[model samples]
Target: MSPRKILGWLRAYAAHDDPLVATANLVALVVASNVPFYPVYHLLLIGRDAWPALLEAPVALIFFAIPWVSRRSGLVGRTLPPLVGVANTLFCMKILGEASGNALFLVPCVVAAAFSFRAKERWVMLPLVWLPVAVFLLSIDRMGAPLAPFTDAQFAAMLRLNAVSTGIFVGFLGMLYGRAGIESARASR
Candidate 1:
């Protein structure tokens, strides 16, 4: 799209209006999912390998917290998408190496894609949710890898979990965004 359109979207996102807040929340969810890694760091009590996930949680939490703080402070709700965009890339990389991490990490991306649609047509973003999920599945199959480690049962469970998580998140975003859109429109009048 044109820069003007992109800027318009960015302006809307930063405005503390409905969709923007919801978008921020989605970004928070993405970071929140990573929160588990912190406990795992202590649980495993490992050294360097665990550090990335360990450090990522708090940073993600801060990103998640910003929108709420900004709302109270009357600051614009900007910063979430860019943060989420970066986080998504990181999560995608993690997924490449870690099979179990895929389901949780996909949450934010799915939510963000949902919010990107006009509230009335948010369902159109459902397919975007499937994209990461499909890649994750294909990854488990080791389609490009030297070998696949998961059994059929494990793969089935992963698919089931992916489907359920995607459904729940997509539904959640749709309802949240849909309500926010209606409320915003009403407030404007």
Candidate 2:
């Protein structure tokens, strides 16, 4: 392509609505999804010796490639990273199945997507809010356990706490990253 065309493409890709905020939220999503899945898969799939080495490759591809690509071409690199990451997470969740840990990698997506909101984009968090609830309820039903057992209320409480705690964590993360996104947008202009 001509130099002018290349430059135009570069601007489009690296041009985030707010780079720092968007990038931070993206990084957080990458962490949230990869963190829980990594150990769970390691324990369930690769045993003690192999998963560590295998894990770094995709993680590197997702995060490192951002600045690397931006520095090199400045095109669609930043713009596309989040979608690529999400697609990869979905694949991982599917391949790992129950061993993926948590459900379907929904938590991280919800959290990251929340930070993407502008005033016009506020609707994004709605589906995100519902995902975990759906996952938890579905899990409970599929597991065929009572929501709370009277004699062993502690186990039920633990389950309830885990769900609530995770929800709160994701919400807090959404708020923090969302604020960062707003600041980044202001700074960009």
Candidate 3:
């Protein structure tokens, strides 16, 4: 297919109001966000420990593959959302373990789940995305010091900042989706 056609296909795929599409879009967003960070982490004098940031690309690729494989194997409708939710939670834990202060990554998955899954499914996913992180944060002392290079104050600040930013992002996405739903409903009527 031509590049334009391929791009159009991807756009349509992502625009679908389905759980699988949300999962794919979330993975794609992570990959897109990570790719540009590589150069900045390497060239800029930000910090030496930013190397782990590069792992997000491959991780997202792996997560992206899950939905594709499950779809091919006829498991998309029954299983994809929960699987993506678990994977997202694991990734959040990995970030926490790495002391990356990027736990905010969970927010997008939760937000996407809101758009994609039924209310019951979202209830399941919401805890999966948050509970582990809450436990990890609470047991930080038991887990020993963070491996990230940041000092205690810096780490705390980063976590707080991530939380605030994630809240804003979730609010924005909620408004945007709510508006779209209203518009579509009106159009249908």
Candidate 4:
């Protein structure tokens, strides 16, 4: 498709009354946006492991393709982002370890789940919301130990990087969900 056509479709796809679908689409777009910067991040950060950091590019592509996938499967579209998010975070934690502060990303993953599901889906969303917490709690000791151990300087820098990045990601999610709330309120009128 032409660039204009693709953009139009993405905009239309993102417009949905279901909070899960809408939020997932936005999250996918935002996550996919980071694929291009993976190389830069690998060079400047993650000095030892170029491949693990770049592995995220494929995940980002998966997020980017979610809209297309969801067109055929609404359930998958609505649920895939958080499921994949938790899994991805876990993978990063295993490789990057607790020192990178990667676990902080789990907070937004749960928060988004809470907001994404409506009354009917609350039960279904509950397990997802806690999955990250459960896994992290069980593996807390391991997550803190860097796989290969970063130097003191690297540890401090990774912590700062993850902290700032998580903050920005959390804020992005808040804005998307917050906008949805406003729309919902206006619709009730």
Best by lDDT: 4
Give the alpha-carbon lDDT of every model: 0.50, 0.47, 0.49, 0.73
Ranking by lDDT: 4, 1, 3, 2
| Candidate 4 C-alpha error for residue 31, in Å | 0.8
Model 3 residue 137 distance off true place after TM-score fit, in angstroms: 5.9
Candidate 2: tens digits of C-alpha lDDT, residues 67-90: 445545333443334444455444
Off by over 4 Å in 2: 1-22, 25-41, 44-56, 68-82, 102-104, 120-172, 175-178, 181-189
Best by TM-score: 4
Residues 1-189, candidate 4, lDDT per residue (tens digit)?
899998888788665665557777878777777755743674487575534565556778777877777777656686777777888788777766776677777887887777766677778688878887897798787655544666667666767777888898888888888887777667768
By TM-score rank, best first, the candidates go 4, 3, 1, 2
User: Which stretch of 10 consecutive residues in model 2 shows the poorest summed lDDT?
Assistant: 145-154
Model 1: what TM-score? 0.46
lDDT of 3: 0.49
